[model samples]
Target: MDPGQGKKAVLNRSCRTNTSFLSFLCVYTIMKWALLSVWDKTGIVDLAQALIQHNFSIMSSGGTGTALAGAGIPFTEVSRYTGFPEMMDGRVKTLHPKVHGGLLGRRQIDDAIMAKYGINRIGLLVVNLYPFERMSRESLPLEKLIEYIDVGGPAMIRAAAKNFKDVAVVVDPSDYPEVVKTLSSNVGFSHEQRLIFAKKAFARTAAYDAAISNHLSNLDNTFPPILTLQFTNGRMLRYGENPHQQAAVYGTTGIAGAEPLQGKQMSYNNYLDVNAGTALLAEFEEPTAVIVKHNNPCGVSVGTDILEAYLSARDVDPVSAYGSVVSLNREVDKKLAEAIDSTFVEVVAAPSFTRDAVEAMRKKENMRVLILPERNTSDEVRTIDGGVLVQRTPAYQENWQVITDRDPTTDEMSALRIAWKVCKHTKSNTIIFADQKRTLGIGAGQMSRVDSAKIAIEKACAPLAGSAVASDAFLPFPDTLEVAAKAGATALVQPGGSIRDDEVIKAANRLNVAMVFTGVRYFRH
Candidate 1:
């Protein structure tokens, strides 16, 4: 096998059987031996201690080995076991004979693999992949992204996972305590337990591989289907959208386990509403806040600060804000916390929160505070009746195009672009009211465009007197634009290809409102 093309791997035949459930954790009292190599070390120290307590010998590579040594815990270095020092800018570790053979070999000595590589033992492998997703999302240069791919880690995990009967693999930190419990119950975890873990290991590896493929491949490469179909063993809600339906809360990659810091056990519909609110709020850069009800935003606002934004959005329609799922682009602060605490909000999602803010929120015994590790609006997905709707993302892409007979003035052009961007994010039959680089109001999903315009006006009741308006599609009639002008909108934006483009433009001219035609239509449906 060529080193340049990745090492060839072989697995010994299965020769082990499983044990019946001993306890919630099939505690194995003894550990024979193990190998560990990881990138993120969340509970590695405790895990290593647990293995040591069980009388297991350890072999590790690089920083992990060094860490164990610093703690006065003895370990066989990967170099000492494989007889090959980690080289190539520290890229070639644990890729040699002894490592793979041990994980992939059955207890009964197999001559085929040994004859090819002269190798023998790894009973268990604990590996967590390099931070590829974290690296890709960073504001890093190309070189950093190149350094994050884990070559040896995934390969070894796959090899051990393929020979599951002979190996125990742990890819997630959360699995450590359970693994330790099972090991302690029985002298050793049986073949079945290992096999179950092996399946999970392979799935984890597949997810990592798919993320890499999608990130590297360009649009024209005809990318493969890669959406995370992850749903951890979270709580089953009382019911779904209504008592007549059924539903469950499914989480995505990186985020695991449902731990609502403050709230009653979340109902299925509550989770859905919270997810929609948080996802929509994440779309803007400003100190934006969104309140969602039944997968639609009842109110949204952007301001220089979070408190003002949340208050403005909340004040839009207090009647609708009741039990609303609220989300903010910025950290939840004291003022915002106080405002939220004084209400009947069901959930509050934000990137983070101050200590005082959290304490304030705790006053509401049933309000949930979800701290989103990362603001994730770059990519999105949704499933429909026939199939899923996939795209680069519908995430408010900046508009740089202009289509109008008379060129808009510089100020009008900037406002048009901003308003257009916000309108694109609002639901179809959309109308967005904007001024001063912030969204004043948004009306979405109306049957008639005129009604949508009216909703936007109603939402921005006070500010409606002097803001600009944006529409996702052509009005097809003059009435809509005339209403927008009547609402004191200073400018208008639409796709502008309707046969009655003349009528719309005429209304714009009559109202002295600067107008633009994007030529591209953006319908959320």
Candidate 2:
């Protein structure tokens, strides 16, 4: 071939390749058609109305179709287009070619195949899934729970998502209005908006299927097989556990179970301290009062009367107890009100309060006194990355018994029980010293177990001599037992765990003090 002819030929080939690539790019950029289906109808009517105004053909299945029809909107049935009925009690709807072909097709490239098969183009897909979490929580029958598992919804969503360059997908109800507004303002959603929506749709579908995957997959060692996570909208609090840091209250999915009555808005730290205070309250069968600060119990006491208990709990750390969050298992009476009059309290949460008692507490206008409406115990939560950790709250010890050489005299055992119960609510390594109806001293948030015991003895003042002591965990060394005994600790309760547990018992024996192993540790941290 001649050199000049070769050059011309090369230029022609380059132009043809450029034109082909440009055509592909243009076709990929242009999208047509839309599919709409949803289980939650909260804002579906408005979304459908907007789509109809925009001249986008709507296709829906089963209840979603019924919902659109009831709202006086017209939509194409997936069954009619696919030539298949929604078999098996409506579970088989939308799992068909007409629905998927529209969602997955590239309008320009797939026209030949679509034309031959008579399939429609789908440019947008908007879908929301059934509430399996809500269903399971309601104690739905096994069959009903299984039925709520969404099939067609996810398939269409995934198809549209995969073809995002030519398709837009919206999975959350919250995104409906925004997507509608953007699409309404322009001929189509911008590439930026489509990209954002596509990412969100995939995430929603992933989380949804993860829930299902965890559900059906059998567990060999994993007790739950599937871990369920439910989060209620978090409320911005006045502050975190501290006023300096910003905080928010992320409520549990068990929202109907929350019961806080008549209190100032809880801060970040307020809720933590209050939960500790309340969990301590659950431990006592009798009327009890517990005051806590920085996740540690400053004072706690069970008494025949509320005022006495409050006074005793307050006495444990009068200085640290200032502005403490307080909780009571029973109603707060006038006497308890009088005891708290001298100090600043962040909150006083109780099941109930007398009219006069409420009036008395109101004297301190700045004080937050809340009444929790729920009388029963429930789970407490701790959040971690990507998932949450939960546990059934340790309830009142109904079966607590003395299991040691020094059997607690009925009276001493009662006091020890109250002290140990409250100790768990304190941040660990924890120690509490009390006698009869009031906390004499408290030591909380220590690094070493023995140090906590020493702090409790120092705080107890003279009361340390005869007061009973509660150790959140066992005396790892016999020295802690010796220290408590020297400080005048008489009766003791602890969850024993040291290898030389017998040595600690021997130390208690030598001191002539009674010791009981609770077999439960109350570690708040």
User: What is residue 521's positional error in candidate 2, in angstroms?
Assistant: 3.9
What does candidate 2's lDDT look like per residue over 374-407, in tens digits? Answer: 5444445578998777676544553354545667
Per-residue lDDT of candidate 1, residues 197-292 (tens digit): 898898888878877777777334644555444434655667887888876665553223445677777777676676666666655777888888
Question: How many pairs of residues collide in each model?
Answer: 13, 7
The lDDT of each candidate is 0.73, 0.74
Model 2 C-alpha RMSD to native: 10.1
